[model samples]
Target: MDRALLNALFDEAVAKAQPELAVTRFLPAQPKGRTLVIGAGKASAQMAAALEKAWPGPIEGLVVTRYGYGQACERIEIVEAAHPVPDAAGLAAAKRIVDMVAGLSADDLVIALISGGGSSLLPAPADGLSFEDEQEINRQLLASGAPIGVMNLVRNQFSTIKGGRLAQAAYPAKVVTLVVSDVPGDDPALVASGPTLPLKGTRADARRFVELYRLDLPAAAIKLLASDENLAPQPDEAVFARNTSATIASAALSLEAAAALARQRGVESAILSDAIEGEAREVARVHAALAKEVAVRNRPFNKPVILLSGGETTVTLRGKGRGGRNGEFLLSLAIELDGVAGVTALAADTDGIDGSEDNAGAFVDGTSASRMRAAGIDPLAYLANNDAYTAFEAIGDLFVTGPTGTNVNDFRAILIR
Candidate 1:
């Protein structure tokens, strides 16, 4: 199997979601009055840059993205902050964005460039919630293994800027949100906790998730959730009546791009799903089962076919090891498919960085586990530690692509030849 072919397929998926290509198509007509842009996510900065190039009218605003994911935009301000965790930088930027949209008139237009990672990138705590408390809440939710839907409900309920508050602030004005979705089913509202879209569920729903996930939230966070504050603006609210949102890029779209490329190159391909979710290792086991079936028995799709899937997976941190969700998934797949010939796979985050490591993901083949063992590293021991980054590193299989400038979620492909 050609590792280069796998890499090319990954590149095609990423190119399909590039901000410059996707954002321009979803951009609304230039407003009659001043256009203000504001957003937050891994792709937001690049999205802003794309907007500036495409929009005819003058645009000025702020967008926050994960550190090192910032893009250079002449008119729009690109603010870099911490991600998968909130920081002082994110809080300040979120505050500024909320303030910026206030006092807008009905004639004005506000465009929100939202994508994955926006939840943590825009951490404007609600009233009486401290920054430290907000940070703790994020850390707890991420480690809790909660699905994105539950996590979004909890996060949006506690945020002053998210959960449609951004749109609420720009109310009376026409707000358009162009999203690069990284969530299951490409739900725009779930993207970045729906900063510009209306809130769904209830505070009680958020509280239920807190308890369900057993989150060790800060006292202030608990109090906020328990309080009967103004419910986040609902879909029926007048403010959202004039607002509009579109998913410009998504896991489904990117997966289709990869599958299309494979078929074009004479390799039969099938997409099992574009919305799978669960613990990283557990998901790997399921995919491995399907791959082994086709590879050995040729029961499902026959040989010389590529299997593709896209979805976000969670990792419950049992041991303090270095890896992103994609790394963890790939490592687990390697172990399950040990010594099986003519099989290769790649699992990566579309935005390039996977978890805490610089590598977007890692490449694994039938002999990946054996390679680790030959290098005196135990595959099971490494996966147990959540140390897939180091495990792949020892065997020179880590895929390092710094910040691909777009995120549609996790991309996984299996080649059975």
Candidate 2:
């Protein structure tokens, strides 16, 4: 398959998740009192723009997005903030969003456009919790190599806007949440820690995860998690009576769009899973084994088929390398498939920014390792140092798409000819 075909597949996956296409149908009927738009994540700006076009009545509120991911919206205010880490702007936005939803009458309406990266973008510290404490906890979570769900579970305990607190503040008012899921199993609550959705686990559950990941949380954070009054509204709470949530974009639909394109091109497509997780390098090794098996024996799937999978993966940050999980996965995959011919693959985050880098992800093939070696770069050393960005950038294989204004987690395609 040509490289253009791979690009086409990735583009199709992203196009399928566009809020312009997904939000219009999910919009609720015109409200009686006021229509308020509020959200936070990488896709909040695009979603706000889409909401402006779809809602019949006047809709005005605030939404926060990552830097450079902002889209112009006349009615809804678009604010840019730091992502994967909370900055003053994000903390301020979170505070404003919570205040916006407070004291609303039952006649009013709240529309929440939640997506990936919302967890860090909306960092409203609960009672007695400080912004610096939340930021430190976020840093710990991102570096802990824990699953996204685990990270969300622990962080939400310290946030006032997360774990359904936003909706709780919106109380009698009807809250409609349109989510672009970036979490495994497409759990709506897990997306951006479910600002408008109900709280997940109990305080005990949060403490358990903190211990499991061995997160060195601040003493205030630990004390706050122990308090029962701070727990966000549960599923059975009356606060969620009028609150409704829908996952507008997800890895599942995005993968199917790519598979459909592959079928139209006469290439068999197989979807492995949409919720794969764990360490990036380990995941890459498994994918490499699958590619080799298909190339050698075609046991699970026939030849000339593209194996597709989606879901977020974690990276254990032991080395001070500049690379995201997708790039790390590809670098490790390249090493494992060193001499296995007839195999090429691409892995990228749908958000267009993998980790904090500009590139979405990278590509790999059988000769990738040798090519790096020829260029005086040791594949094993790069992989060990967690420097996939440098390695792939040196070889001109990084997939740079800028900000696609969406996040469906990771998309990986392995083509075997």
Q: Give all TM-scores, in the order shown.
A: 0.98, 0.98
lDDT string, candidate 1, 1-417, tens digits: 478999999999999999999888887987778799999999999999999999887889999999999988899999999998998899889889989999999889999999999999999888888888888888888888888998888888778888888898888889999999999888899999999997578888888888888899888877778889856878888778888899999989899999999988899899999999999999999999999999889978899999999989999888888999999999999999998988899999999999978999999899999999999989999999999999999999999999999999999999999
TM-score for candidate 1: 0.98
| Candidate 2, superposed: residue stretches over 4 Å from native | none
Pairs in clash, predicted candidate 2: none
Q: How far is candidate 2 from the true structure (C-alpha RMSD, Å)?
A: 1.0
Q: What is the lDDT of residue 357 in candidate 1?
A: 81
Give the C-alpha miss distance for residue 231 in model 1, angstroms: 2.9
lDDT of each: 0.91, 0.90
Q: Give the worst 10-residue stretch by lDDT in candidate 2.
A: 225-234
Q: What is the C-alpha RMSD of each candidate to the true structure, in Å?
A: 1.1, 1.0
lDDT of 2 at 240: 88
